[model samples]
Target chain A: MKFGFLMREIGQGLSRNVSMIVSIILVTFLSLTFVGTAGLLQAQIGQMKTYWYDKAQVAIYLCTDTSPADACPQGEASSDVKATVEAALKDAALTPFVERYYFEDHQAAYDKFQEQFADNAVAKYVKKEQLNETYWVKVKDPNKSAVIVESFTGVAGVEEVRDQRSYLDQIFSILNAASIAAVGIAAIMLASAVLLISTTIRLSAFSRRREIGIMRLVGASNFYIQLPFILEGVVAATIGSVLASGAVVAIVVFFVQGYLAQRLPLTSFVGVDDALLLMPLIIGSGVVLAAIASGFAIRRYLKI
Target chain B: MISFSNVTKQHKGAPKPALDAVSLEIERGDFVFLVGASGSGKSTLLRLMLREEIASRGDLFVLGQNLVTIPSRKVPALRRKMGVVFQDFRLLPNKTVFQNVAFSLEVIGKSSAYIADAVPEVLRLVGLEEKADRLPNELSGGEQQRVALARAIVNKPDLLLADEPTGNLDPATSAGIVSLLEKINQNGTTIVMATHDVGIVDRLKRRVIELRGGVIVRDDKKSGYETALPITDQVPISSDTEPEQGNEPEQANEPEQGNEPESRISSTDQAEEQE
Candidate 1:
């Protein structure tokens, strides 16, 4: 193949169908953006899962002075009951499941509540005596919090044994659903991109049938006749892919790292590095899919 | 050289065969005229020779290869040794005369250094050397055909097939194109031209093979457009037993097979543009 000749042909073909080529680029851009978004969403979900789960704890809340008489006949968790509960946590049956443990007295719990709900009207009426003293146990594996729950539930002076993951699981499920939705939309868009690329190629082929006819007569091989048209599609799609990668980077920089990270400081969000990692895949797929589509569209005209 | 032995070409759904039980021989360097009316198998015979259409039955050979069994992959190699000219000049309207002739060589992966040299040489032969920068529309019908001829012969094909090359030219211009073909023929390239131009045909007095209703009725070494009989005569002559030319024996080679319908693809590369 003559490099100069092939380049000239490709340039002419692109110029002849400028509007169609632009549409191809825009469609590929939109579809690949969706794909990149889906990819990043999944990555973000993975990051949040590890961050939240690592800090998950099983909180054992003891009865306060306001506890009902049926559960706490002494009206509050006594010194003896606290000693018994602490001994039980140290027992061999519970020791194997515990990674580490800490205690929060009524004063500490009252201070945390006030810090969390500082702007709420109810926080002004809450007293340190009414708050429960708690044992916050970090387990060896977050999923094994059930072992601690079974050991402490209904024990004297225990008001409730709660797993933090139960609440976090709901948020994760919703996030998982959101990521799945992104992937579904991405699939539909990518399909449209494929179809649009093929149609653009068909129109391009029809417009250049004369040149193609001459090329065939001159004994140009099938690959030679088809190379320029295929390159035209690949070129347009690559531009779109690059634009999409730029969009994804902006989203990470402006929306994720800058915005979501600032608003939600506790959980880690997907960063610019993750978005950068997806660039090659996005661009590579765009190139490959365009080649396949245009290659298929030009087959009828290459009867030789 | 081309040989067709009892070749029968029948298109699907057509009521009759385009060429039926035809047997003929065209020796190397021979210029043969195929004269027939529209739909009288002249085009079909040219298409068969080009391997654009496969014979439904019998044997066909060109340039020492059995076309009946030539693989489709090898068809390009066979076509490289032959050139075709059509009634329409089929010159690229946007291309100047120089680029038009160079296009044929370029398509076949010729180096620019070679195209730069051969294009001008072929242009000189067709008498279009002075119009190298002029587009197709800027030239007269005869000059455009000269460019077409130059393009067809740039690679020095062993055989040239002209399908009504003079069909679109005036008589004076047609004579010029025919003479150029005669010159190319004299250079040892075989020429087979299909036409209905009786004047040029009668004037040239080359070997004429006339067809009627998909069968050959006449083959004469020195003949004119019409016989002493009626010009509309229709007859199917029996396959001739002419002694095969003993120039070269058929070589033993593997036989391959392919079938592709003839292409009537139209091109607008010659659309006229205002200067």
Candidate 2:
């Protein structure tokens, strides 16, 4: 019951089972690290969805004089054809789905092409009339891109209807799959951690049974007798969680912010601040798991 | 301080009960010797008094608490008022003699200053003050038993129950240990010693309770180890048989006696050999 004596016993127990304790710490670290990584990946996906979804577009390109697309049967789109397509986009049924739209003419497309590929031989060969005129449509619901693409893809004067959101969805699903895999691995590793914690506690209890019996004879309370073994588990698991938290912080600080942030500027990523929020949950998991495992171990093995 | 009324204890599936309908009273300061042969219920009676095993039938009480009805949570509190010594000496091998004694106090939440005061006092009582820093393995058998005694008595319990305290020592060392128990008892602790070493019991001439097959066959005041049975009864034959069998092995393994230069040199010789 004295703090000094209790601390000494706990320290002795930890040292005696150093190898087992180390395994518990490493397993807990591995499992919780996976949990933290999965959480951050999901956060990154959420950030990307918010930043990119509002800007998703369906770009319907008009035919040009030298168009390579099969749908562009006419040599060039006339002003009359442009008016007809614009009228169809503004029709009552399609109007509700279209938030807004803007047109890019042959001259504007040629200017963009010149700026993007100024040194290319293809740009030197192309004329302003050869460039396509495109309509960039903003939608009321980003998920409704299929409706717009399907309705206008083969329409006369249209070369192609490209939904930019489809590309982002593909990327998001891949990230989601990775997160699920991380969670699955975390579950298996956490099971190993829990088993190791309980086993370490049980072994300590058995090895000290003679001492425990003496204490029982001398009237030491049940709590006093069992405190050291339980503390063994709690201390090991907490150490693991502390290391795992540090690993998560390092990834967010150095890898995500320092490295990936610069390389992938097209999307928003989870920052250190978001990862820091998970520290409490990570440490709490360690503490609660140790407490429960040791509690069950003591109940079954220590019998007090 | 202890009483049993018609108590019976049965080991599950064993053909005979450990104790059967045994009623006896041990008052506050009674120094009683539990004398019996193997399987004669001496150890079982001691275990019952310690509440290690409950009475299967009838009422058993020690230190004013019913052994059966008392909640398991309160067992430690009840046990704290009594000290117990075993044949094996049960000292923590890693701890020094001083720490071993201090351990008993620490378990009951004694303050640091109290432990510091009480531990050395108990060590001194056991005449191991000079060897307090020595670990159990470092001490001789008698000295290790002394440390176990110091540990048991440190908390200053009201009852001291010793199950074969000198079972592993020479007669000379056993005599020394019995004197220590007698000293503690004179200080007002009730002593209940269960032992088959007949020499000390006969010399002490204390209350002797003899048992056979769970029944109390003899309970005598101021009696020796031999049951105070009538000469015509069959007990004398059994009592006569015990010394021949029990005392022979003890005499054969009697290590050099007393605090002589002979004993000291041999112990040091042993310490060197171990190293």
Candidate 3:
């Protein structure tokens, strides 16, 4: 029941099995780091969903005077054909899918293209008459862009229908796979951490069993006998979790926010606040995991 | 004070019960010896009193708490009332004699000041004050047992239960240990010691409870036997008041029952603080 005595015993336990404790710490650290990384990756995915998905449009290009597509069979879309396509966008069957629609004239498209390719040698040969007009459509659901694309793909005067969600799907799938891999690695490491904590507790308890037997014979309570051993596992796991939290914060701040943010200004990365928020979860898991491991270990290895 | 009412402790696979329907009453300040052969249930009786094992079929009252009904969680607090010494001199190998004695006080939540004052006093009581700093391994078997005794009685327990306390020592050393038990008994602490040391039993002439084949073969107010002899037919279980066939002496020593060690614990704690 003396705090000083229990603390000294815990210190002795850790010192006697330094290598085993270190391994426990390292395993917990690695597992929690992966957990934090997976968390941050999920956060980034959420942020990208808001940032890129909002900007993801379904672009419907209208045929121009010099258009070669079969849908533009008149060499250019007639004003009547353009009017018909515009009417179809507002038709009751397709109207529910479209959030808003904007038509870019041939001249506006020509000017934007010319400005984007201002330094290109082929720019002078590209005339306003050759540019295609476009109806840039924003859908209520980015995932449902296929519905809008199918509705307008073969319409007269429409050259092509491109859904930006397709590009997002490819990018998100890759990110999702990477996140899953991080979680997979984290799961394995977490299991190893639990096993290591249990082993550390068992070895420490076994080594100090003579003292434990004396304590029991001398009328020490069960909790008094078990505390020092449990504290050993908790101490190692806490240090491991702290290290993992540090690594997580470093990755979020230095790598994700600083380096990646600078390198990819268009992409949004998880910030330090998000990383700090995930810390409680990582640290909590470390504590709870160690507590459970030590609980079982003590139950198995100690008569008390 | 301890009382066993028809206590029967039967092991699962053993041929017979370790203790069979035997009643016993031990008073405070009584120096009693539990004598039997290798498997006569002496150790089992001590363990039953300590609440390490419960009575299989009957009630046992030790230090006024019913051993059968007491909650298992409260066993440690109950054990704190009495001291137990083992054959192996179960001392901490790494701790010096002083620290080893202090360790018991430290565990029961005694303050540092109390531990510092009480540990040396206990060592002095056991005449090991000079060897207070020596580790257990450095001391002889008798000295180590003394240190163990010091640790057990440092808290001023109401009773002491020793199972083969002198088993590891020589005859001379065993005599010294028996004298220590008698001294503690004279100081009003009851001592229940189980041993096969016939010489010490004959010399002490204290109350002897002889067990044979899991039954109390003899219980005399004052008894001395030269060797373990089977005499089951001479003494019967129904003869609680009747005397057995022995050169038994008429005695007039009876200890008052119901001395609560919990009160003594608080007083000792306060005494440590006051000093």
User: Candidate 1, TM-score vs. the true structure?
Assistant: 0.84
Pairs that collide, model 1:
B69-B256
Tell me each candidate's TM-score. Answer: 0.84, 0.80, 0.84
Q: DockQ of candidate 2? A: 0.58
Worst 10 residues of 1 chain A by lDDT: A68-77
* Candidate 2 iRMSD in angstroms: 1.2
Top candidate on lDDT is 2
> Looking at candidate 3, what is the lDDT of residue B11?
90
Candidate 2: pairs in clash: none
- What lDDT tens digits, residue by residue, belong to model 1 across residues A1-304? 9999999998998899899899889988988898899889889878877988888899988888797767666667778878887898898988888988998999999999999999999999999989889999999988789999988888888888899999988988888888788778878888888888788888888888877777777677778888898899999999999999899999999999889899988768999899999999899988998998888877754677
* All candidates: CA RMSD (Å): 8.8, 6.9, 8.9
List residue ranges in candidate 3 displaced over 4 A: A61-81, A84-99, A105-133, A139-162, B227-230, B235-275
- Give candidate 2 misplaced runs (Cα > 4 Å): A58-99, A103-164, B228-275
Error of 1 at A129 (Å): 6.9
Better of 1 and 3 by DockQ: 1
lDDT of 1 by residue, B1-275 (tens): 79999999999999879898889999999999997556668899999998889999999999988989998778877888898899898889999999988988898899999999999999999998899999999999999999999988999999999998977776667777888999999999999999766666666789999776677768888797657234323331423311131111111001111101111011111111100
Please compute DockQ, using alpha carbons, for every candidate against the native two-chain complex: 0.48, 0.58, 0.46
**Tens digits of per-residue lDDT for model 2, B1-275:** 78899999999999868887889999998899987656768899988888888889999999999997888899999988999998889999989999888888898899989988998888889999999899999998899999988888888889999998887876667778888999999999999998766667767789988776677767888886554446215444335433432432223223422223344344334433433
